[model samples]
Target: DAGITQSPRYKITETGRQVTLMCHQTWSHSYMFWYRQDLGHGLRLIYYSAAADITDKGEVPDGYVVSRSKTENFPLTLESATRSQTSVYFCASSTSGRLGYFGPGTRLTVT
Candidate 1:
Protein backbone atom coordinates (compact mmCIF):
# COMPACT_ATOMS: atom_id res chain seq x y z
CA ASP A 1 0.00 0.00 0.00
CA ALA A 2 1.98 2.94 -1.28
CA GLY A 3 -0.85 5.10 -0.05
CA ILE A 4 -2.68 5.34 3.26
CA THR A 5 -5.64 3.19 4.30
CA GLN A 6 -8.17 3.25 7.13
CA SER A 7 -10.21 0.52 8.73
CA PRO A 8 -13.87 0.57 9.78
CA ARG A 9 -14.67 3.28 7.24
CA TYR A 10 -17.84 3.89 9.24
CA LYS A 11 -18.66 3.42 12.88
CA ILE A 12 -21.50 3.94 15.33
CA THR A 13 -20.82 3.90 19.03
CA GLU A 14 -22.58 4.87 22.21
CA THR A 15 -21.51 7.76 24.34
CA GLY A 16 -19.00 7.20 27.15
CA ARG A 17 -17.52 4.21 25.39
CA GLN A 18 -14.11 3.78 23.82
CA VAL A 19 -13.51 3.44 20.12
CA THR A 20 -10.37 3.15 18.11
CA LEU A 21 -9.77 3.98 14.46
CA MET A 22 -6.97 2.33 12.59
CA CYS A 23 -4.69 3.70 9.91
CA HIS A 24 -1.87 2.19 7.90
CA GLN A 25 0.52 3.29 5.22
CA THR A 26 3.20 1.63 3.15
CA TRP A 27 5.37 4.68 2.46
CA SER A 28 6.92 4.51 5.93
CA HIS A 29 6.45 8.23 6.17
CA SER A 30 7.82 10.13 9.12
CA TYR A 31 4.62 11.94 9.96
CA MET A 32 1.12 10.69 10.68
CA PHE A 33 -1.86 12.87 11.57
CA TRP A 34 -5.44 12.38 12.76
CA TYR A 35 -8.07 14.97 12.07
CA ARG A 36 -11.82 15.27 12.56
CA GLN A 37 -14.10 17.30 10.34
CA ASP A 38 -17.39 18.80 11.47
CA LEU A 39 -20.02 21.00 9.91
CA GLY A 40 -18.76 24.30 11.31
CA HIS A 41 -15.18 23.43 12.07
CA GLY A 42 -13.10 22.29 9.20
CA LEU A 43 -10.48 19.64 9.67
CA ARG A 44 -9.27 19.87 13.26
CA LEU A 45 -6.22 17.94 14.25
CA ILE A 46 -6.69 15.48 17.09
CA TYR A 47 -3.13 14.27 17.30
CA TYR A 48 0.02 13.62 15.30
CA SER A 49 2.90 11.21 15.70
CA ALA A 50 6.33 11.99 14.35
CA ALA A 51 7.82 8.56 14.88
CA ALA A 52 7.55 5.44 16.98
CA ASP A 53 6.60 6.33 20.56
CA ILE A 54 6.76 10.03 19.66
CA THR A 55 3.29 11.48 19.63
CA ASP A 56 1.83 14.90 20.40
CA LYS A 57 -1.57 16.38 20.92
CA GLY A 58 -2.97 18.63 18.27
CA GLU A 59 -5.68 21.31 18.05
CA VAL A 60 -8.42 19.09 19.49
CA PRO A 61 -7.08 16.23 21.55
CA ASP A 62 -9.27 16.57 24.58
CA GLY A 63 -10.88 13.15 24.38
CA TYR A 64 -8.64 11.47 21.86
CA VAL A 65 -5.28 9.78 21.99
CA VAL A 66 -2.82 8.50 19.42
CA SER A 67 0.26 6.31 19.26
CA ARG A 68 2.87 5.40 16.70
CA SER A 69 4.59 2.21 17.74
CA LYS A 70 5.43 1.54 14.09
CA THR A 71 5.97 3.98 11.27
CA GLU A 72 3.45 2.17 9.08
CA ASN A 73 0.57 2.17 11.55
CA PHE A 74 -0.97 5.05 13.47
CA PRO A 75 -4.05 4.38 15.55
CA LEU A 76 -6.34 6.94 17.18
CA THR A 77 -8.41 6.11 20.22
CA LEU A 78 -11.35 7.93 21.67
CA GLU A 79 -11.07 7.51 25.39
CA SER A 80 -14.60 8.52 26.29
CA ALA A 81 -16.91 9.16 23.42
CA THR A 82 -19.51 11.92 23.40
CA ARG A 83 -22.07 13.31 21.02
CA SER A 84 -19.75 16.17 20.23
CA GLN A 85 -17.05 13.74 19.17
CA THR A 86 -19.07 12.42 16.30
CA SER A 87 -17.48 13.44 13.06
CA VAL A 88 -15.61 12.24 10.04
CA TYR A 89 -12.09 11.31 10.95
CA PHE A 90 -9.29 11.28 8.45
CA CYS A 91 -5.86 9.73 8.69
CA ALA A 92 -2.97 11.06 6.71
CA SER A 93 0.73 10.33 6.24
CA SER A 94 3.54 12.36 4.79
CA THR A 95 7.28 12.65 4.60
CA SER A 96 9.26 15.19 6.58
CA GLY A 97 7.98 18.08 4.56
CA ARG A 98 5.56 17.34 1.75
CA LEU A 99 1.95 16.77 0.80
CA GLY A 100 0.26 14.03 2.77
CA TYR A 101 -1.57 11.04 1.37
CA PHE A 102 -4.99 10.84 3.05
CA GLY A 103 -6.97 7.74 3.84
CA PRO A 104 -10.55 7.21 2.78
CA GLY A 105 -11.64 8.32 6.29
CA THR A 106 -13.77 6.81 9.06
CA ARG A 107 -17.07 8.38 9.93
CA LEU A 108 -17.96 7.97 13.60
CA THR A 109 -21.36 8.61 15.06
CA VAL A 110 -21.95 8.82 18.77
CA THR A 111 -25.40 8.29 20.11
Candidate 2:
Protein backbone atom coordinates (compact mmCIF):
# COMPACT_ATOMS: atom_id res chain seq x y z
CA ASP A 1 0.00 0.00 0.00
CA ALA A 2 1.16 3.52 -0.66
CA GLY A 3 1.77 4.85 2.81
CA ILE A 4 1.41 8.40 1.62
CA THR A 5 1.52 10.23 -1.72
CA GLN A 6 1.31 13.74 -3.17
CA SER A 7 0.21 14.55 -6.67
CA PRO A 8 1.74 16.86 -9.26
CA ARG A 9 5.19 16.25 -7.82
CA TYR A 10 6.26 19.34 -9.71
CA LYS A 11 4.12 22.36 -10.59
CA ILE A 12 4.69 25.78 -12.09
CA THR A 13 2.14 28.56 -12.18
CA GLU A 14 1.85 32.28 -12.57
CA THR A 15 1.46 34.62 -9.65
CA GLY A 16 -2.17 35.28 -8.64
CA ARG A 17 -3.27 31.94 -10.05
CA GLN A 18 -4.94 29.27 -8.01
CA VAL A 19 -3.07 26.04 -7.23
CA THR A 20 -4.22 22.94 -5.45
CA LEU A 21 -1.93 20.18 -4.17
CA MET A 22 -3.39 16.78 -3.48
CA CYS A 23 -2.30 14.35 -0.79
CA HIS A 24 -3.46 10.86 0.08
CA GLN A 25 -2.49 8.08 2.48
CA THR A 26 -3.50 4.49 2.94
CA TRP A 27 -3.30 4.53 6.71
CA SER A 28 -6.29 5.91 8.56
CA HIS A 29 -4.35 8.02 10.96
CA SER A 30 -6.15 10.31 13.36
CA TYR A 31 -4.01 13.30 12.45
CA MET A 32 -2.82 14.79 9.19
CA PHE A 33 -0.70 17.85 8.45
CA TRP A 34 0.42 20.12 5.63
CA TYR A 35 3.84 21.75 5.66
CA ARG A 36 6.00 23.77 3.33
CA GLN A 37 9.78 23.73 3.08
CA ASP A 38 11.84 26.69 1.96
CA LEU A 39 15.53 27.50 1.71
CA GLY A 40 15.95 29.16 5.11
CA HIS A 41 12.51 28.72 6.65
CA GLY A 42 13.05 24.96 6.79
CA LEU A 43 9.64 23.35 7.36
CA ARG A 44 6.65 25.24 8.59
CA LEU A 45 3.28 23.76 9.38
CA ILE A 46 0.50 25.24 7.33
CA TYR A 47 -2.53 23.31 8.59
CA TYR A 48 -3.62 20.15 10.34
CA SER A 49 -6.73 18.04 10.94
CA ALA A 50 -7.43 15.67 13.76
CA ALA A 51 -10.23 13.91 11.90
CA ALA A 52 -12.66 14.37 9.12
CA ASP A 53 -14.18 17.85 9.29
CA ILE A 54 -11.96 18.79 12.21
CA THR A 55 -9.17 21.09 11.01
CA ASP A 56 -7.06 23.81 12.56
CA LYS A 57 -4.83 26.46 11.09
CA GLY A 58 -1.14 26.08 11.71
CA GLU A 59 1.72 28.54 12.00
CA VAL A 60 1.59 29.73 8.38
CA PRO A 61 -2.01 29.46 7.26
CA ASP A 62 -2.24 32.71 5.45
CA GLY A 63 -2.86 32.47 1.66
CA TYR A 64 -3.54 28.76 1.95
CA VAL A 65 -6.48 26.51 2.76
CA VAL A 66 -6.89 22.86 3.71
CA SER A 67 -9.70 20.37 4.24
CA ARG A 68 -9.96 16.79 5.44
CA SER A 69 -13.32 15.26 4.57
CA LYS A 70 -11.87 11.78 4.73
CA THR A 71 -9.30 10.13 6.89
CA GLU A 72 -7.06 9.27 3.97
CA ASN A 73 -7.04 12.48 1.98
CA PHE A 74 -6.03 16.06 2.71
CA PRO A 75 -5.86 18.68 -0.01
CA LEU A 76 -4.20 22.10 0.17
CA THR A 77 -5.12 25.07 -1.97
CA LEU A 78 -3.51 28.43 -2.48
CA GLU A 79 -6.20 31.06 -3.02
CA SER A 80 -3.83 33.25 -4.94
CA ALA A 81 -0.46 31.81 -5.64
CA THR A 82 2.54 34.06 -5.21
CA ARG A 83 6.26 33.82 -5.95
CA SER A 84 7.02 33.75 -2.24
CA GLN A 85 4.70 30.77 -1.93
CA THR A 86 6.90 28.66 -4.15
CA SER A 87 8.31 25.82 -2.11
CA VAL A 88 8.27 22.10 -1.52
CA TYR A 89 5.04 21.01 0.14
CA PHE A 90 4.81 17.90 2.25
CA CYS A 91 1.80 15.95 3.61
CA ALA A 92 2.14 13.95 6.77
CA SER A 93 0.00 11.61 8.86
CA SER A 94 0.21 10.24 12.36
CA THR A 95 -1.77 8.69 15.19
CA SER A 96 -2.39 11.03 18.07
CA GLY A 97 1.10 12.25 19.14
CA ARG A 98 2.98 9.51 17.37
CA LEU A 99 5.67 10.12 14.81
CA GLY A 100 4.27 11.21 11.46
CA TYR A 101 4.86 9.61 8.08
CA PHE A 102 5.50 12.15 5.37
CA GLY A 103 4.65 11.88 1.72
CA PRO A 104 6.97 12.65 -1.16
CA GLY A 105 6.74 16.41 -1.44
CA THR A 106 5.36 18.49 -4.29
CA ARG A 107 7.73 21.16 -5.55
CA LEU A 108 5.85 24.25 -6.67
CA THR A 109 7.22 27.28 -8.47
CA VAL A 110 5.27 30.45 -8.99
CA THR A 111 6.43 33.04 -11.48
Candidate 3:
Protein backbone atom coordinates (compact mmCIF):
# COMPACT_ATOMS: atom_id res chain seq x y z
CA ASP A 1 0.00 0.00 0.00
CA ALA A 2 1.54 3.30 -1.17
CA GLY A 3 -0.49 4.90 1.57
CA ILE A 4 -1.01 8.41 2.80
CA THR A 5 1.89 9.65 0.72
CA GLN A 6 1.50 13.15 2.00
CA SER A 7 1.20 13.48 5.75
CA PRO A 8 3.29 15.22 8.36
CA ARG A 9 6.70 13.63 7.96
CA TYR A 10 8.23 15.02 11.11
CA LYS A 11 9.04 12.67 13.98
CA ILE A 12 6.94 12.40 17.11
CA THR A 13 9.49 10.56 19.28
CA GLU A 14 14.68 7.43 20.69
CA THR A 15 16.91 4.49 21.05
CA GLY A 16 20.64 4.04 20.87
CA ARG A 17 22.43 0.80 19.93
CA GLN A 18 20.41 -2.35 19.28
CA VAL A 19 16.80 -1.41 19.78
CA THR A 20 13.35 -2.76 19.12
CA LEU A 21 10.19 -0.72 18.87
CA MET A 22 6.83 -2.35 19.35
CA CYS A 23 3.45 -1.26 18.02
CA HIS A 24 0.11 -2.55 19.10
CA GLN A 25 -3.33 -1.64 17.84
CA THR A 26 -6.62 -2.74 19.37
CA TRP A 27 -8.65 -2.33 16.20
CA SER A 28 -7.34 -5.55 14.69
CA HIS A 29 -6.47 -4.02 11.35
CA SER A 30 -4.94 -6.43 8.86
CA TYR A 31 -2.22 -4.14 7.52
CA MET A 32 0.67 -2.78 9.51
CA PHE A 33 3.63 -0.64 8.40
CA TRP A 34 6.88 0.81 9.65
CA TYR A 35 8.52 4.08 8.67
CA ARG A 36 11.47 6.18 9.64
CA GLN A 37 11.29 9.96 9.84
CA ASP A 38 14.29 12.14 9.28
CA LEU A 39 14.62 15.90 9.03
CA GLY A 40 15.24 16.22 5.28
CA HIS A 41 13.96 12.92 3.96
CA GLY A 42 10.69 12.99 5.81
CA LEU A 43 9.11 9.61 6.44
CA ARG A 44 10.56 6.71 4.50
CA LEU A 45 8.90 3.32 4.41
CA ILE A 46 10.99 0.60 5.92
CA TYR A 47 8.72 -2.42 5.92
CA TYR A 48 5.12 -3.55 6.06
CA SER A 49 3.04 -6.63 6.65
CA ALA A 50 -0.35 -7.45 5.35
CA ALA A 51 -1.08 -10.05 8.01
CA ALA A 52 0.55 -12.18 10.59
CA ASP A 53 3.63 -13.97 9.22
CA ILE A 54 3.41 -11.99 5.99
CA THR A 55 5.80 -9.15 5.32
CA ASP A 56 7.35 -7.03 2.58
CA LYS A 57 10.18 -4.60 2.10
CA GLY A 58 9.68 -0.93 1.47
CA GLU A 59 11.83 1.96 0.20
CA VAL A 60 14.52 1.93 2.89
CA PRO A 61 14.39 -1.61 4.24
CA ASP A 62 18.14 -1.93 4.41
CA GLY A 63 19.53 -2.35 7.93
CA TYR A 64 15.99 -2.65 9.28
CA VAL A 65 13.73 -5.59 9.96
CA VAL A 66 10.09 -6.16 10.91
CA SER A 67 7.88 -8.97 12.10
CA ARG A 68 4.20 -9.52 12.75
CA SER A 69 3.03 -12.57 14.59
CA LYS A 70 -0.30 -11.30 15.83
CA THR A 71 -2.95 -9.06 14.41
CA GLU A 72 -2.32 -6.29 16.92
CA ASN A 73 1.43 -6.42 17.26
CA PHE A 74 4.20 -5.24 14.96
CA PRO A 75 7.78 -4.97 16.01
CA LEU A 76 10.72 -3.35 14.25
CA THR A 77 14.32 -4.26 14.78
CA LEU A 78 17.46 -2.44 13.72
CA GLU A 79 20.49 -4.62 13.18
CA SER A 80 24.15 -3.66 13.56
CA ALA A 81 23.15 -0.10 14.31
CA THR A 82 24.79 2.76 12.45
CA ARG A 83 24.62 6.48 12.93
CA SER A 84 22.82 6.77 9.62
CA GLN A 85 20.01 4.64 11.05
CA THR A 86 19.17 7.32 13.57
CA SER A 87 15.62 8.56 13.11
CA VAL A 88 12.11 8.48 14.57
CA TYR A 89 10.17 5.38 13.64
CA PHE A 90 6.45 5.27 13.17
CA CYS A 91 4.08 2.32 13.08
CA ALA A 92 0.77 2.43 11.31
CA SER A 93 -2.26 0.28 10.58
CA SER A 94 -5.06 0.30 8.06
CA THR A 95 -7.89 -1.85 6.86
CA SER A 96 -7.81 -0.54 3.31
CA GLY A 97 -4.82 0.31 1.18
CA ARG A 98 -4.52 3.71 2.78
CA LEU A 99 -3.07 4.25 6.22
CA GLY A 100 -5.67 4.92 8.89
CA TYR A 101 -3.83 5.14 12.19
CA PHE A 102 -0.31 5.78 13.40
CA GLY A 103 1.37 4.77 16.64
CA PRO A 104 3.56 7.13 18.54
CA GLY A 105 7.05 7.10 17.02
CA THR A 106 10.08 5.56 18.67
CA ARG A 107 13.43 7.21 18.15
CA LEU A 108 16.53 5.22 17.31
CA THR A 109 19.99 6.75 17.26
CA VAL A 110 23.06 4.67 16.59
CA THR A 111 26.32 5.97 17.92
Error of 3 at 96 (Å): 0.8
Instruction: Write model 1 residue lDDT over 22-111, tens digit each, in one string.
Output: 999999899999999999899999899888889999999998888888989999999999999999999999887698889999999999
Q: Is candidate 2 or 3 superior in lDDT?
A: 2
lDDT of each: 0.93, 0.95, 0.76
Off by over 4 Å in 1: none
Best by lDDT: 2
**How well does model 2 score by local distance difference test?**
0.95
lDDT of 3 by residue, 1-111 (tens): 323231233422233456567788778789989988899998899999999999999999988888888988888877657778878888889998665788767765555
lDDT tens digits by residue: candidate 2, 1-111? 769999999999999999999999998998999999998898999999999999999999999998888899999999999999999999999997688999999999999
TM-score of 3: 0.80
